[model samples]
Target: MQILSRPYGALHYRLDGPEGTPVVLMANSLGTDLRLWDAVLPLLPRGLRYLRYDKQGHGLSDLGQADRIADHAADAEALIEAVATGPVVMVGLSIGGLIAQHLAAGRPDLVRALVLSNTAARLGTPDSWQARIDAVEQRGMASIADAVMERWFAAPFRATPALALWRNMLARTPAAGYVAACRALAEADHRQATAALRLPAMVIAGDADGASPADLVRATADLIPGATFHLIPGAGHLPCVETPAAHAALMTPFLERHAR
Candidate 1:
């Protein structure tokens, strides 16, 4: 129930682990909350602090007027400055990846490394995002939940009872918040900024992810100066949710070098 106030509203966040440890910040995807990375946290090594928060308009945070990734990035920057002991290993998923790009490029001092997961410099096209916005706004979050689920997970995972959890999570999102994030994705294109980055970085993609496919994600990785890319077979967009162990395995060593 920790909270941080900003001009927009209050941000809900949770920071775990003891004081003075290297911080690892986890940012959520669209239509999700801070809990998105819950399964991935414990799998990582100990001796590090974990910072996760619900973005404005998602989870328990206030829905601010700002709808741009830059605004979200600024919010993350503010949170890190107020809470983290120093630079952190930022793990950004989907739209969260865009925010991390902006934050790292603008406030390089706040980030020690990056793990851009199931995301890209730019996501769907403006027209595509506009259509998605129209659907959710007109028909509500439920209207797009099924389609989103398809892109989010593969067929096998969808059949499992666990899929109900994420499906329910999507159906419950605030339409206003979801729409705002869509607008941000429509306007975002971080290729230039991501390319200019020189920090230790990794880009991960689920082989079956329809939203940000492996090739698309690999392309984004290529833009980075030295970012390593990994393809998780049979997984979808949020591999951290679908296969946290695999996600953690790829990240642990990287974190050890940069974060610890």
Candidate 2:
């Protein structure tokens, strides 16, 4: 783990593989830290550089004034610019996908390719997200950890030890930061921005994902004009956890093909 100071606060990140090799920066889903990529990390080709970081308020990253997805994207851009060089393959999931879209649209020079997984161009989150943010602000992160976890993973994942670990992480998250992230998701609108991105892109979705359905993923892929779409079976939102091998197989080629 390494700490890099940004304009808002310190950002926590892990860098792997060779420094001079092609860089891959991974942004994780909401409510999940960089640990969410643990299962898929080892599957990546070792010759390339990789960076995984906890968004503000998640994992070991600092809690900054983040109340919108743009703020998150700015922080991410700052981190990438501070650490990696030009033209990185940015891989993002869930809310991270929105951030990636924002980055690619706003700062195309830094992004060479994109992998958006289990996410949408625009998150049509119902009022439930706002309600949850209010609940967290009023009560605490613990107040909604269970409910959030239920929505994060599928039924089978909830029965595993990994679920317990995830729950613990949620419980430990600062309520203020969690609420901030919730508010960010509530205000984010990536539809227009993502539609305009012309980078080499891949959209990976889980057939069983309720959050970002397959049809939505297909629509997003269609909008990207020649973007590749891969749907993994027996997986929900977190395909890297539910079907790591399949997820890795699909991503390995895409990343390698686009690597500079």
Candidate 3:
């Protein structure tokens, strides 16, 4: 792991492959660390630069109080400027996707391409999301981690060792940090910004993803002119975890097509 100091706080990240190669910046969803990409990383073709980072208050990154998605995007920009060379292909999941949308729209020069997975342009926390946030805040992530796990993985995945590992990780997340992220999700609105993005983009969603259903994902793709949309069957919110090979297959073509 590498550490870089930014104005907001210290950022934790990992770099892989050659430095001069085209860069792909991978960002995790809310409550997840950079390790969330562990399965997908090995499937990616070598010889390309890759940057994976834990968002503020997750994993080894600083646990600061960030309430807005813009603040998160700024942090991501700081990390990109510090580590990557020129524009990058930004791949983000869930809340990470929201950050990517904000950054791609707000700072077009910094992004070469975008891949959003299991995310929506306007992921407004429904009544259930708010209730879950409140529950986590009051009783800690452990209290609701199981329920969240059920939503994240498919029925068959629940019986796998990976599921247990993921549940453990989610259960251990800091309540404060989790709640802060929830607040960010609760207040985010990327619909307008995503509609304005002209850069090469793709949207991938799990067919069984309840958080961001297929229709919503398709709607997001439609909002972005000429963006490609792919769906991974039998997977839920976390496709990288449930179906890493499919995730890589969908992403490889998009990245290769847009490679600089």
lDDT leader: 1
User: Candidate 1 lDDT, tens digit per residue, 8-58?
Assistant: 789999999889998998889999999898898999988988999998898
Off by over 4 Å in 2: none
TM-score of 1: 0.98
Q: How far is candidate 2 from the true structure (C-alpha RMSD, Å)?
A: 1.5
Judged by whole-model lDDT over C-alpha atoms, candidate 3 comes out at 0.86
Point out the higher-scoring one by TM-score: 1 or 2: 1
Q: Local error of candidate 2 at 241, Å?
A: 1.8
Give the clash count for model 2.
Answer: 0
- Please state the error at residue 141 of candidate 2 in Å: 2.2
Residues 67-122 of candidate 3 have per-residue lDDT tens digits of 78887888889878987778899999999999999999999999999999999897
Task: Rank candidates by TM-score, best first.
Answer: 1, 3, 2
**What's the true lDDT of residue 56 in model 3?**
84
lDDT tens digits, residue span 1-260, model 2: 69988776788999888777778999998778888889998997778888899999888888888888888888878877887877899999988898898899999999999999988887767486888877877888788878766656678877888788888888887777788887888888777778888889999988778678888877888878779999988788888877899999999999889976
Worst 10 residues of 2 by lDDT: 145-154
- The lowest-lDDT stretch of 10 consecutive residues in candidate 3 is 123-132
Candidate 1 residue-wise lDDT at 109 = 95
Off by over 4 Å in 1: none
> In angstroms, how far off is 33's CA in candidate 3?
0.5
